[model samples]
Target: MTKTIKTVSFAAAAILVVIICTFLIIRQTHENVLSKETVVKKVEASYEGKVTKATQSKDKKTYDITLENPKGTYFVKADAISADILSMNRVKAVNPSAMTEKEAEHLALERVPGTVKKQTRQSQVATYTIQKEDGKTYEVKVDMQAKTVLSADQISSKDQQKTPITKKEAKTIAERKTGGTADDADLEESEGTLIFEVDVDLPDNKEATVKINAYTGKVANIVYED
Candidate 1:
């Protein structure tokens, strides 16, 4: 009778161990499944920014986007994921005045006449410091989104010649006399004489400031700051 009782007790203990093991295995499996599902959901959400161009990878699992303003680009993985684009190719979210770097460059070239001495895109506008062959420098601003010239004026100079000078004529003359390519000058009107300036780097740092004449295509000064 005692032997039978002992046998029964052993049987019960074995059953309990099996039950506990099974429960643990099932819980671990469920947790792993939940974790995987969460990760998948996050990948399906859309990311918005200024998209210059979008190209799907050959595997069709990734997308590369180029942004404007700071001229930055990024790549995102898109495999087994979904995304919705609210807007594309926009420089900013609310302001339509925001412009892309390429657009700003075009506007500056059209309005400012002289060769681009130094051109930079900041906050959607293209700021150009131009130098003409005649020894003058000018500062010009172009709005990329509006496709309009914001401002065009020669740097401070002593020359004063008030005869209306066409941008084309000024460029040609500056190029010939400067013994340099016309592409380096910004031709505009100043005190009166045509001027040209060029980009110059200060001894302190690699930064450059462009100088040009307002009337003639002459580069006079370039002070680099920061």
Candidate 2:
């Protein structure tokens, strides 16, 4: 009878240990399954720049992202389960041969022959909103890197019917708020709402990305990098 009692106690203790270990494993797995947005935020924080592209592994256990800043472009990989930086490498540097803003402006003016009302850079292209002497407006796109004219389209009256705010207006708001140069402007949809995203270049190699509401022209969000 004594032996049987001792055996039963030992088995119960073993079962309890197994249960606790199983619980811990389950909790860890759940915690490691991070959301895509969370992973993106982590990558941006680590790289101190904008993530231009992101992709996940087939097993969803790893994430790869491409980050870009004034300095250059970088490729980053992190473990999804641990959120650890597996590796980061710079893929490209800023092109030294890229044409300057003034040179691009010249190309645009030669294409449209108008006074530049507003100019913005997006990717490798410089876009200009030029107004003619007769009050006509045109949109011109120039390849800043190649120093070539991409397109020159007349701004129709119908095209003037835009959202509550214009890209130029958004850039102005961002620059005023951050005291930086607005480099790029784009319109994007987030959660079924339209927002204008403006990238601002600050001193000391810092940068800020400002998002403004399209309907109300209010600032929606600002992500700053240092």
Candidate 3:
């Protein structure tokens, strides 16, 4: 009887140990599965927003961002985010909801030489255009001041058409203009006027250029760094 009782007790203890180990293993497995599932879900959710357009400055120093949403539009600055996120490849994948419109605008302006010229709010989103020192222009859209750029496009003038100019005609025109180059002169798309782009190279390797209507040839713009 004593031997039987001892045997029964040992079996009961062995069963309890097995039960505990099984419970722990199952719990750990459930936890591992949940963790992986959470990560996958997060990754999938990160790509919720769509990017419309992106442009970098001519110097490759600044980035312009634009995004479109069902409500309206948004903007972001590439430098405000990590450099890793600034690449054209990554910019295409940014989630605009993660940042504010103001934040995005600041990020873009910080990387470029300009200030926000105007901000217009319409319904669900806001639009901002930046005017730099040298006639460079940038337009951005954002929902709030969080500074995320929903969509960004650089402003540049369309190329004008070229008109025929004889060498004597070019030289005569060049002679009348101060600080002008015949090599820089070209014809306007309107064909009624001539266009000349004045190149003033700055010490920083940044050029302060201007486009003039060469026939009427009035200074169309004082700055032309598009």
Which predicted model would earn the best lDDT?
2
The local distance difference test score of each candidate is: 0.53, 0.86, 0.52
User: Can you write out model 3's per-residue Cα lDDT over 16-123, one digit (the tens) per residue?
Assistant: 999999999867644443232333233224444455555654534434555544545555434322222343223223344544556656665764548775566675
lDDT of 2 by residue, 89-177 (tens): 99998865889899999989887887887787898899898889888989899988888998999887667434346788899999999
Candidate 1 per-residue lDDT over residues 32-116, each given as its tens digit: 3323233234433344334445455453334444444333334333332333232234334343555677667666666656677
Q: Please identify which of the two predictions, 1 or 3, would achieve the higher TM-score against the true structure.
A: 1
lDDT ranking, high to low: 2, 1, 3
Q: How many steric overlaps are in each model, in order?
A: 46, 0, 38
* TM-score of every candidate relative to the true structure: 0.27, 0.34, 0.23
Candidate 3 global Cα RMSD:
20.7
